[model samples]
Target: MARADALEKLRETLINRRRALVRSATGELNQLQGRSAKTGDLLDAVAESLQSELNSQLLEAESRELTAIDDALERLDQGEFGKCEACDRAIPLTRLRAVPYAKECIECHRASVKRRSHPAATINRVFDSYQRAQ
Candidate 1:
């Protein structure tokens, strides 16, 4: 694809996501700041615990997205922006339109998803060990 086309797509994505990002971050900050004024330590612990979990997940997703965008931009600099990372094939324009941060072609992405969905580990330790032992 042309350089102008890639830039236009990138700008559109930035414009669409920027306001939402700002709103999310600002809302979280306001809640965290207002928390102390509105409640005691016990209530604050509950609220902050929930907010911290939520914010952590959101931040992680945002970090992944930013990394992808940076990778795409770097690829553009090297004139390989639309190539699939897994297969070294040219990613389809339609897929690129739908997902500008896609690093793999459709086939490879689907295969990867399939593999991820059936993860081998059943012992994901999200629960405390003592609780589990009980």
Candidate 2:
């Protein structure tokens, strides 16, 4: 298929996915809110609070994904949809198929993952070093 046609298809898919995600997230949040209002017992209140926290985290993640989808749609409008933002290389159709909102090519994405140093990794390394020194 032509690049423009592919981009249009991807744009439609992302928009639909975004709508579904928003609806699901909204329904779940509403359920949690309703449940929280009726929790009279301490344990029930605690459980509802935990559920609400988890729902909030999930909603946060969904919101981020929604933002990415929106950005991809904007990029489609700008005629830069399939190009990797990091390397300016054409992102593979396969990758775009797998992740409609992907911003970087596989190689650039892998390099970015490699370059990142997580706090958990640092903490683990420090603990291992301290254990070895004992």
lDDT of each: 0.61, 0.75
Candidate 1 lDDT, 18-124, residue by residue in tens: 44545665676666566555546787689777887777665555545555556666777787777898999888877676566567888998787778862211111
Give stretches of model 2 more than 4 Å off.
117-134
Q: Candidate 2, 76: how far from true, in Å? A: 0.3
Candidate 1 Cα errors over 4 Å, as ranges: 1-8, 11-38, 41-44, 117-134
TM-score of 1: 0.63
> Residue 33 of model 1: what lDDT?
64
**Residue range with the least summed lDDT across 10 consecutive positions in model 2:** 118-127
Q: RMSD in angstroms, all models?
A: 10.2, 10.4
Residue 133, model 1: lDDT of 58
